[model samples]
Target: MWSRALRSNLKLSKSEACIFFKNKIRGASTCVEGEPEGPVVKTDIPGPKSKQLLQELGSLQQVGTIQLFANYDKSIGNYLVDADDNILLDTYTQISSLPLGYNHPELLKVFNDQHNMKCLINRPALGVFPGEDWPKRLNGILSEISPKLPNITTMMCGSCSNENAFKNIFIAYQRKKRGDVDFSEEEKSSCVLNQPPGAPKLSIMSFKNAFHGRTLGSLSTTHSKYIHKIDIPSFDWPIATFPQYKYPLEDNQRENEEQDKKCLSEVEELFEKYEKKGIPVAGIIVEPIQSEGGDNEASPQFFQQLQKIAKKNNAYLLIDEVQTGGGCTGKFWCHEHFNLETPPDIVTFSKKMQLGGYFHTAEMTPRQPARVFNTWMGDPGKLIILQTVLRVIKEQKLLDNVLHTGTLLKIGLLELEKEFCYLLNSTRGRGTFLAVNATDSKLRDEILTKLKAKGIQSGGCGSNSVRLRPALIFQEHHANIFLDKFRQVLKEIN
Candidate 1:
């Protein structure tokens, strides 16, 4: 019945419906017209061509992270084509960066406009000199996707966005303390020398398993992995514990509530501890769902209480939505699901948004010019692409599609968890940004390898969780493909 409904909604014929269900549908769907019927594996993932290219590129640079060389030109929606002509269903979607997927027709045609072409060719130092249309473009974007924050400061990428957002928060924190007073001479001179009163020992509190960024300041707050911080001189900042809830949350409500209380208590203690140490926390940065650290999630009640705590301490809350934004979570932002009493002080974004930046409250906007300035603050070309992406998202009601497909996917995963009992568990997440855990990291890696061999390109996070970061256009059929492939992988492992 559901399959029939899907066919009716998508307007697929009998043969087309069969292919869609069987995970083989050649260019027949309207949503992603040129997308392949399903993944086609012609060779081993790092096939002959990719291996040779990796060897060639390895000579000039460290290529440890290069998994496989891709042929973007041949790639289509929900599918990535490798240099060896193997087509794989790309659930990770370039680490959750691709919004509409590879070679999206609308995105490809965006540069066809002479104005957009000029925006790409004549990139300006946006801080110093912006085109006349820059303000108009920004206004359109703000109107369409501002998260209710009035001000936005665009930047280069996720790292810099978080880095600069920390600065903004610190500036606001100090400005509130200064109370319209001009900077004193000592503050100016001391800051020049990186001393007290100028470069005050302010800090941004982050969670234990958080992955904000790798810039000098943001790196100090990042605690996900040792390699990201090894040998780097980091500030002495307070690290709070993020809530670690047990799986099947409904069945573990009391335990999860206690976990939230425990984590929140840690946060309050750290606030006081930092205050007493003379290095007050200016802000708290967190991911709605800790993407890189793990697909760890906290309850909406936890976020509401955390926001209240931030208000009580006068420290701003900065939600890092770099990976969880852009309608993947069945909403424009994952934090929206939390329904906080008030909006976060700053909401940093990038990933699917094309350009990186933060939506900040009026107070968070620095009073002094150039306080958070940078050359080429953001690219107009990227904004042009983003505008099209947003349009497509709304026109197709992709958010609704995400919710529907996510329900089916999650249900399928839960069933698999029951069937594969020992091998899989802890299925969690919203929309298509879902994840399931294996027994251990080794088994997780093995599962991912087997899935990829079956032409499903997925990713792992934290230690043993397989995360799904499919494009927003991912539909019911796509979810079926992944579930089918995943079930096969589990069977093999068993």
Candidate 2:
């Protein structure tokens, strides 16, 4: 019965699907032709199925953060269906990871090709034994979404992407130290014992409230939440301040500039202090727009200046775009907005890109093999999905949609801020990678809860920010629904 309904919901007719790639922009109707006109809240948020499943799952493992269980098959287009069958306009988009909403027809058909099916089932140990078409698959990703960086090292997830990028940076730094000399036996021997010279006391500079990932090495750089980092011992690396720009940025121009200056100065000071203290900073990893940290954005000048600083300090700069990349900011890589003199030493990505990897310069390439090696470097199946996703993005002109849709969402947010000045503030972000701060953390969570009840799924970042991370295919009509629902929720909150 659901399949019958789902079939009707999928605007999978060849004509409707092909409407965008050829003629003028056709909007999201072509993407999910039979998608719901608006969200349908069938139950009270977590409803019955969600609560029951949560309880059942809770008995097995930790499910503290499990807000609701999703019925992925039933989910379509921009809507997510919870276990209770309540449909939500999923602005959160599986933590900003889903490029297209659930079950895009093009993607669903990918496995129809036997070769693609074989690739899906026969997962290879990519590092040791990649399939014949691996290089082509990799090159496809590069050609389609290259950050202008020369090489890429694929890994398992966002954490490992940054983790291995850190290794690459360290290896490069060490190679520079080695110059023409070969590694001494003592260096090798001491490294085995986790001692100096080989396993040197190097550090990566990260920002306060920045979230790179949760793996040990990457976790050290993640300062978004105490919950993610507490209990586990972490590296004592430098944590510089990310600029907290005042909202109504036009009104706070001078102050924001000063904020950037102060933050940059501290970054410089950290480099000097760390260098003198013996634990030299090998790399600097920062998110383009700190998503989990509350959608904090810095000036292009700040990034440009930071890049220069990385060069000055002989440290590699890594732009962590796990959340901000994949055309969310109307660019393939969010760092493109910075307009740096040259590409940064490395750019790490995952989440929405279908795989975790870092696009890097040749200098960062480890001379030694297995330094960044793992059993399965990255899933080939994901590459297949990614290739299709990239094609759809190009054919449908999702970037253009993002730019236009983002403009509408931003304008609406500004208007809402005006009307609910006391309840909301600090409206900012790029594209649909947007967020707004409520009066306090309680209010922020309340806004998310209310939004969910209203059949819109929003996420909260920082202490008081309600983040909007709609899918790439999200259009003006979706934005209107979100804006309307948001206004309704705000009125009720007031």
Candidate 3:
């Protein structure tokens, strides 16, 4: 029954199903079609066919977090379709990774280009033998979005980008400590055995609820959930408290300022303690807005002071924009909102950029090349896609759209909080990267489940916060549609 309903929803033909790229990709004429007329739901979410497919997938792997199987071919614009044919207005956008939503025309056009096809089919080992055009491609893309930093290093994803960035910090720190001398024979031999004088006891400082990644070095800095770190061996790195601001920010300015002071003080104390213990902190890493840790935010003053603290303690600073970058926060780089006196020593990104890498000042560039190297540093195919995405962003002025829509979302969430005071509070965010807290975890889960059934898919973060990570193309009309459905859900729960 659900399958039949789903077929009706798509209204597609056999040839259309085989090519599947019709209507979405346009010709030499480049005008984009506006947003579709809201979402269309053909069946209940996770209808019978979806349940059977999920059971089959579960037998093959640990499919615990699987929500509904996606019909990638059918999903387009801002709407998502599941195997059961239920269509949802997707606000989560694949854990905040889909930049232009699904199947944007410009992205689809890459398949027709012969050069892009060659790059995709023949992956190169970037460290040893890159294609001749590799350097030119790197310069063009990296320079365009190079934050305030001058150099760029590419990697596979968020985890490895940060893990290698951590290594870059350690290498720079050790090089500074050694001054002009060559490594001692003892130091060289000891390093081979993973010991001191070579391996070193340096560390990276992270905030209490921050998340860098899940690899060994990056995992040491990730503190969002214990389950991610349970059995993995980690370093004894320092973790400072990130400021917990109060709601209706205008009403709690003084208290929020006090919160900032208390957290900054704790960070200083940890730096001193770690130094005294001989495990000097080589770097400090943090998210512009703590997305995984409940969307916690800090004032620009807090980040400015934090950078000063790092400089005073002779530690490098790395800003992880894996989840916050690519204009979700109304700026190309979210940290740009902080108005820091200088760019951070390193800024790492992945997610929506279509690749993972870090930007750094010339001083932070590794003295050795292969020391910070990887296979296929990042795929050329992803760069081709990023080029198209970047073009669309500029031509369409998507950043302006983000701001226009974000205000609507923020205001709506605030009004909802007032209407459902007992159930929610503390709405916060920049641009469309917004979130609000329920009184507790159980209520938060209920809100999320009901929102999905209503055809609006939201995601939760930290403990009790529902985060909004809409695509850059999200507009005022889409925001209104979401607001209306969300209000209806709140009414039912009340």
Identify the candidate with maximal lDDT: 1
Report lDDT per candidate. Answer: 0.90, 0.87, 0.85
The digit string of per-residue lDDT tens for model 3 on 68-146 reads: 8988888877888778777788899999998899888889899698988998889888788778888898898767888
Q: How many pairs collide in each candidate, listed in order?
A: 1, 0, 0
Expressed as tens digits, the lDDT of each residue in 97-191 for candidate 2 is 99988889899999999999999899999988899999988888787778888799998899999999999998999889889578999899999
RMSD in angstroms, candidate 2? 7.2
Ranking of all predicted structures according to TM-score, beginning with the best and ending with the worst: 1, 2, 3
* Candidate 1 stretches greater than 4 Å from native: 1-29
Clash-forming residue pairs, model 2: none
- What TM-score would candidate 3 get against the native? 0.92
Per-candidate TM equals: 0.94, 0.94, 0.92
Model 1, span 1-494: residue lDDT tens: 98887666433457545644543323314478878889999999899999999999999999999999999999998999999999999999999999998898888899889989998999999988999999999988888898899999999899999999999998999989989889999999999999989889998899998998899988988888899999999999999999987988767889999999999999999999999999999889999999888899998999999999999999999999999999998789999989898889999999899999999999988777899998899899999999999999998777767766776788799899999989988999987889999999999999999999999999999999999999988988888899999999899889
Backbone clash total, candidate 3: 0
